[model samples]
Structure formats: C-alpha cells, structure tokens
Target chain A: MSRDENAAGRTMLEVDRLAKRLGEFSISNVSFTIDEGEYFVLLGASGTGKTVLLETLTGVIQPDSGRVVLAGRDITRERMQRRKLGIVFQDQALFPHMSVGRNIAYGPASSGMKRSDIEKLVESLASGMGIGHLLDRGPATLSSGEAQRSALARALAMGPDCLLLDEPLSSLDSGARVEIRTLLKKLNRGGMTMLHVTHDYEEAVALATKIGIMENGTVVQVDTPQRILTHPGSEFVARFVGIRNVYRGRLRRESDGTSLFESGSEAPFRLETLCEAIEGEATAVVRSEDVTLSAYRPDTSARNLFEGTVSEIVPARRGAEVTIDAGAMIVAMVTERSVEALGLERGNRVFASIKASAVRIIEG
Target chain B: MIISRIEPMHLIFAALGGALLLFIVAPLAGMFLNVGKAELSEAAADPEVTGSIRLTLLSSMGATLIAAIGAVPFAWILARKDFPFKRLVNGIVDLPIVIPHSAAGIALLGVLAPGTPVGSLGERLGVTFIGGIAGIMAAMAFVSIPFLVNAARDGFAAVPVRLEQAALNLGASPLRVFLTISVPMAWRSIISGLVLMWARGMSEFGAVLIIAYHPMITPVLIYERFGAFGLKYARPVTVLFVAVCLVFFLALRMIAGRRSHVEG
Candidate 1:
C-alpha cells in the first residue's frame, strides 16, 4: 500500500482506528483518510456504522479510542465548532424556525462576521446553490430538493475545510438525487474535499474519487471506484459492489498455458481462462453486466462459456436480471430488449459467456 | 346541527364537561357582574389596590425572569442528558405542583426564616428573604419554577437533536447552538412556559402570605379586603384584578403568537 504516495498531497482528513461503542452498535477499529480535494465515499449497507463513523469524524460522537486528524491537527478532543467540519444529514435538518437566508447566515453571524458581510455571504451562497429565490422562504415551506440545497448552502457558508455528508442524497427523489449528485461533483471539482457516506452503489460510483466499503463496523476495502468495482478484495465487497456472480473454485494450470477453473463438487464444471494460473483454492468474481447471454453458443474467442438454464428472470432498472444455474448460480444483467429477443424466462436454456479479463480472482 | 354527529353518550359526556366549565366560569362572571362600574372605578383609584396590583405584576415577572436564568439550563439538561436519577429530578421539579400550597409555604418559611441558615447567608449578602420583595419573589419562584423547567424541557425535547448537531457542525458553539437553534426552535413552548409560570406566580396566595404579608400581592389584598369587609367590597377588587390579568395574559399570548408566526 503506497501510503507515502497516497499521502503525497496534503491530507485533509484522517480517521485513524476510531472506535465507539453505542449501545449494541459499535464502530470498531475504523481508519481511513481523505486527501485534499478528494470526494471520498464511505459505501456501506444500512446498520454498517457509516453514519456513526461520520459522526465520530465530526466530533459529534466521541470515539472511545483513536484520533481524528483534520488538516494535520488532531481534532479528536476538539469541540465540534473548533474542528470546522460541516455536515449535511439525509433529512437536511434545516432549522425550521429560520428562514433560508438566516439559516445559511447562522454560521458566519455566530462567528461574529459583520452584518453586511454575513448578508453578502448568504446571498452568494444562496445564489450559488440556486436557492436565491428561496432565501426569504421558511424552511418548512421548501420542498425536499429545495431543503437539500439550503442545507448545502448552510454548510458551505462556514467555508469548512471538508464537508461530511451522511447519505445526503438518500432522502431525495431520483431526480433530486441526480441533481445533488451533480452538485456534489461540481463542488469537488472546485477543490472542496468531501467525505460522503451512502449505501447506494450508484452514488459511490458516480461521485467517489476514493471508495471505502464498510461492513459490520469496519472498513473492508478501500480503493478507487473502478478498482473496487472490478477487483474487490473480499466476497463481501465483491457482492456489495454489484459483482453478482461469485464462485469458489480451484485453479488448475493447463499444459496449454491456460487455467481451468472448476467450481462446485456436486456437479463440477470447468471454465478455461487466459490468465496466470495459481494452483490453489480461489474465489472468482464476475460482474452481472460482464456476462453476455446468448440463445446459442456462438463461436467466439471468449475464454469462458457455460450452457445453463435460466432459473429466474426479474425486471431491474433499465434491464432484467437473469439468474442462470450453470453448475453454480450466475446472474447476468441483460437489457429488456435482449430478454424479449432471446425469449428468456425461468427454465429457458441459455449460454452465458464471460471473457478472461473480466473474471476477477481473489485467492484464499 | 353541529351536535348531530355526536353520539348520545358523547353528548352526555360533553354536557358534563360543559357543566364543569360553567362551575369554574360562574363565580368569576358573577363577581364581575356584581361589581358596579362605580365600585370598580373606586377600587382602581384606591392607592393600596393599585399598589398591590403593581407589586403582583412586577414581583411575578421578576420571579419568572430570575428563575428562568437557572431553569432554562436545567431544562436543557433534563431534555438532553442521560444522568442517573434524572426521572427523580424531573419528579422533584414537579413536586411543588402536587404538594399543597400552604405546605409549600411552610417548607419555604422553614428555610427562609430569619434565624435559618439560608436567611443568615442572605443577610451576609445584604439580602433578606422574609417579609420583603425578595421573599415574595422567592416564594412565587419556588411555586412556579417547575412550570418553566418542565415546559422548557419538553420544548428542548421536541427540538431535533440533529438540528443542534447541524448548527454545531456549522461552527456554532454548544451555547450558541442552544440559543440560536434549540431555544428559538422551542420558543413557543418556552414562551408558554413563562406565561404559565408568571400567571401561576401572580395568583399565589398561601405561599406568598407566609413569606411576605406586608407587601401585599393582589391575591392577598383580595383576601384581606374580603376578610375585613365582605363579598361586596372584595368583588370590585377581584373583578379589577381579574380583568387586568385577562388583558395582560391575552396581550402576552398575542405577542408570543405573532413572534412565532413571523419567525416561522
């Protein structure tokens, strides 16, 4: 792990082995860092302690152990105001008693900025968030999207060194989610370091410069989004990043410089792949989108092809999920048009083809 | 016609509740009706009655303001913190409301009497809490602090913890968050609490009677006038005091309502 290379840029936020025990839920030995200007996403499912970790970073929850270093200073014991970390919650949490403008102005005004300067700053931030028309409106009257923008403006008004977002887009509709996701990306491009937590894989992929997958109170994997999606470190991460087909297999090196992969003892089937063969038990991961479904096994240079029966077909977003039982269950995501054209359904015979490069191997 | 939707049993219950309302309103209305306009005017012109009314208003307001300084923080803690015996503390704060007012007076006098330790401490500080405005305010505050604390606690509880956290994240100190976010958000409840405490303190007789009988609050004056003369003489002062209370209470409520509306 190139820690020095990763630390080459100014580290904006570092959470080192932070642990907190809250009732039955606990954040155990969590550690991660965000470099300057990086949009780091902590990706996890519900009850995975993502919010707790974010709270710990913000000094809202005192960690029982470990340090939170922000901009090279340890802020584990510092008060939340002195730490200067801003957060936008999923519900937006706008002060209902305050107007939009006043809510945004709260930070600067409390810090003793001149009245005129606070007004100007509020105007600038509201306009920047596209909520200038809403400044005079009460927060209770704003729609969810409007509230989210106001919350963003309020957090940005503080000019915080880094922003912590706890599922900031989770409560928005699909349209609003896209809008805020774009806004987040735009903010990141403008050199604002962000630590965003979400359970949505699409959000992590769409916004993260670095992705950390958290599970059961600990970070299971941390890498770039593309790397994490393609080459997950563990089965939990492999499934979490939407790699639908995971098989425990034995890798046998063929004499022809190919690797023969066999999965399942009851009905063993072999797949040939053009990669370096390691002779050991391993877990093979293939993304649902990486598997191509065909009515017939056509002649192709693709190294792995399995003839199987479609056991279930479920409609998914913009596509259909077809689960194929080819000795081991494999899920393939195909377009709805493909599903119709191929006449795919439960109990239909199909061929699933995967390429050698698309097959990821995790050694045990 | 509006009663057409009501069931027979519900109508009976509503009639009973209405009778209870009448039982409370009749005496006050009868007293107001019995007091002639000339008698009310005479009572209003009397220096002692006016002075007592002024004392009642000022001392009650003073007690509320003084108690609020301590009670608001205590309420915030009760709402937000998880300390051992918190429920007990809450119940103790409410004990004054349940105990007899005369008993409260006895308890206050035991601590505030001239020879008591607290009285000695007050003497050293050049402040006395017996037969003085200080004693009257203390008695009023002792009976009324619960209203402010309990209501403020509920108000603080109703405020979302996340909103306070959001303010803190925006670089507001805890105290700043309390004042700017928590208190303002809970302003309606706190204002209602203050009004309730003030009104309760103004009407206090048994406690204030034991603590300070010389500086007569309106309730004591009404009692004294009733004892010395009869219903006719006391009714005019009662009507005047009740009218004053109703007017000021409504005004305060209007102010609170308007402020909340504007802030919202």
Candidate 2:
C-alpha cells in the first residue's frame, strides 16, 4: 500500500468504477490510479481482461460506465484521436506501407507539425531507441526487436503525458524481450509515465514500481512489487506470484517463546516460524529461492531444517529447481554451480534449511 | 514414410485441368485464325465498329467510377461493422451476380424506365436513362457492380483493424486514417476489383439490350452483326475486340502490380 518516493504523490491517470462488456466477458467496477513517473504494471494470466483494460484506457474501447481522467482532463467520452494516449500493441502494428521514419512521424504530421521538425523528431527518437539506421527501412525487413523499437519510437513521437503498452514484449524472443525490457526501464527512469499490461510475473517484477494483480476482470490487489511478492494479499495472489511452498497448518506458541507450526493431513510436517498470530489454523508461504540445500547438516542461524531426499531436478530460469521430499514436499532453487557442488541428483539424500523469518504467514 | 513421387491422382488432376484450359482457349483461337488480316482491317476501319468499341470502354469506365464513389465506403462498412440485417445486405450485394441478366434488366426497368419517378426526375435534370448512354451505364453497373463491392470488402477485411486503431490512437482523425491508412493498404485489391467490374460491364449483353439497344456497345454490335450477317462478319469483329481487350487488361494488371509493390 505504500507508494515509492519517486511517485511524488501526484496522480497522472485515474480510473473510477470503469465498466465494460464485450460479449460475455466484462470488467466491472475497476478502479486504480497511476502516479507521475511511476511504471505501473497490470499482471494477470490469459483471459483476465488485461488487454481489454488497456484498450479501454487508450480510448480504443468506450466504457459502459465510469470515468477516465488523464492528466487532470476527463476523457471518458473523448474520441481516441483526442485522448492523447499512446499504445504499443503486442504485434507492433507499424504501418507497413510507410517506412520506419514515416511511421514515427505519423502523429506529428497529423498534428500539422513542420516537415523539418517532424524529421528531426523521428531521427532523435529512432536514435534513442537504437534504431537510427533503420529509419529508411520498411517494417517487414526488420527483426522482431527492431520492429518493437520502431513501435516504441512511434508511440513516443507525440510526447504524450502517459503511455499504455498492451503486452508489448509477449511476442518477442528472449533476447528481444531483454532488450525491450531494458529500454522500458530506461524510459521509466527518464520520468516517462507508463502503464504496462502483461502476464509475465518476472517482467512485472523487473520493470514495475507498482504492480496490480487482476483476477476475473477486477483489480484484486495493488502494491509495491516487493510487498506483492513477499506479502501476497490472498492465496491466489500467493500462488500467482510463484510462492512454491504453501501449507495449510495450525500455529502454536511454544514455551520457549517461539511459534511452532504443524501442517495437516498426509505428509504432515512442523516448522518453527516467526508468526505473531494467536494459536489457531493458518497458511504458510515460502518462496523456493529462500530455501537452501546442503549435502550434510551443520550448525546455522536458520531455525528450521529438514532432511529429505532430492525427488526431482528441473531446469528453470538460470537455476535448477530441486524438489526435496522431507515429511512434506519442499522445492528449493539453486544455481547450476551449487547443484554440481552439492552433487545433487534424483533420490540423493539432502538437507533443506529455511529461516524462520522466511516463512510468511497468511491468516484466513 | 512420406511419398515423394507423383501418383495416379496427380496425372488425373493435370489431365482434367488441361482439358478445361483447352476448352477456354479453343473458341478464341479459332476466331482469331479464321479472321484474315484484310477482314480485320475492314472491321477496324468501320466507324460503327470503332465507335461502339469506344462507347463500350467509356461507358464501362463511367459506370466503374460512379459505383466506386459509393462502393468503397460501403465496402468499408461491410468489412468493419456488424449491424442488423448485415447478412441480408451482403446477400443483396451479390444478387446481381446470381440473377438472370434479362431479369436484372427488367428489375432496372421497373425503377428507371422513362415513366418511373427516378427516370422522370433524371429526364427533368437533363440526364435521361432510356435509350441513352446513361441507360447503358446503369445496366452495366447493375450487373457488374458486385465485383467491385466484394473485392473492396475483401481488401478492407485483409487490412488489420489494429493498424487503424493504432493510427487513431496516434492522434490521426478517423477520416485521415481511412484516407491514409485503410485505403492505401487496400489499394491493390480495390484496383483489381475496379478492373474486374469494368471488364464485366464491357461484356454485358442482355441488360444493355433491354435498356439501350440503340447506342450499341461492342457486345451488342457483335450480336447485331452475327444475327444479320452470320459467322464470317462476326468473327472479324470478335477477334479484333478480344485483342484490344487483352491489351488493356494486361496494362491495367501491370499497373496494379507495380503500385502494390511500391506502396507495400
């Protein structure tokens, strides 16, 4: 709930009770605010109305009800051309009939800017996007990354108060994704307000100052990325943000002034936690990356430790996910070097260590 | 394993396709061969023959231009919008293609004959339709307009709607988007449709016969020559007319091809 200090407490765009119905899928009572200089990302899975919400904000789709105020102007009923909001689509819908330079200059030309000024604007924007040499080339000839850079330049040509991006990086390969992500971060750092929509949680974590989690066509939770990752508001949010270890358990206060948590059902296990909740049933969430693995047990400050067999080793983003079966299943993320150093393999006996503070508690 | 060799079915398909191609080529080849250079020269020199050919091209061109003024925008609507009776309207656009040509002329007569309100208004406005060039154009457009409308609709349909939306979001008005983005992207298809409509109109027989038989287009003149003077007279005009039509068709096609590549 706390805003980043760079947000400056000034709202650039606000959506109030926005409602839209397209056939059977409808988003209702959606409300959020994006401050100036903030990169707000709306994160959700497919079919969650992320693109629809983005298009509605861009004035491509009119809401059945509610108000959209942008830069202190009410634009609920404004036409798309007058809204002054720019969007970069997932496919990078550049005008194929025009060269990259003309594509970038389309907005400026439409506003009746001088031809020389428009050319200068196109050059400066293209160079900043690292596409300076591609201005005279057609969009069909460019690679996916270059096309996206051209699209971003086109959207930024008019120097609008805010920009909306609709799954811009979803269609790119990994290299292009990283390149565009870096470009987006650079733009945010230069004080450009942006609202990006994507299903990639890693993308949100890397780029957003504030993240809004949407579910079933509604904005369910909005907070800083750090808070949303460590302190999810609901079980769905926790699972969505990739909290790999979640258990339904009961909390008990130990005589030694620590909390002892015991899970229920088959494969029941107990762990020491730092939860302040009264002795009752609760949920515990632990991130996979927070768990450490070792071949032999040693004295450490981590309060909870379990000896189990390594059940599976799966490759992940820059690491191997090692699934350990203690009393209950626990997944730990370790680098490839660590996997080799610890001689990890399937059915290898291993010890998993987790700090008490790493165990997050969510009460029902 | 995948079969890489040609099968019996492939030979059968080739034979059937070749037979159809020969059927189309035989009559035109026979007419061209039978017409001596002297006969062709005679037909070309005849003012009546030359005037009718000129009239045919000019009237078809006029019909195409007049129809396109409205058809392009109407095609955009058909491609982009969903409205009540849209299916019905689409079916109606294709009605002329399936209906009997004489029946279409009769239908046109019901609304545009001299005694009808539209024809009477046209007469008062110095634009008579019955037995005039206007009547020929009306009949030609009535029969061939579907080609243009359908082609333009398909052309507009193939243009991604997202591009237009992007243009609108970039601060271009709707009218500007249509002029600069939609029409240019769909230009080749529209041109192809126009050429097809013009060619179809030029060859129309029954409708023009019913509406304006006096101001003879090439088809009507050929029909008249055949009915009166038999095979020898008709063959020369037919060969010459086909040659001229082929030349113009190829030229238009080349132009359309070049424009698409340049714009694309």
Q: In terms of TM-score, which candidate is strongest?
A: 2
Expressed as tens digits, the lDDT of each residue in A13-131 for candidate 2 is: 88888999998788988889999899999999888888778888888788999889998899999989988788999999999999999999999999889999999999999999999
TM-score of chain A of each: 0.70, 0.70
DockQ of each: 0.58, 0.64
| Weakest 10 consecutive residues of candidate 1 chain B by summed lDDT | B1-10
Clashing pairs in 2: none
Model 1, runs deviating above 4 Å: A1-8, A244-364, B1-5, B121-128
Query: Ten consecutive residues with minimal summed lDDT in candidate 1 chain A?
Result: A1-10
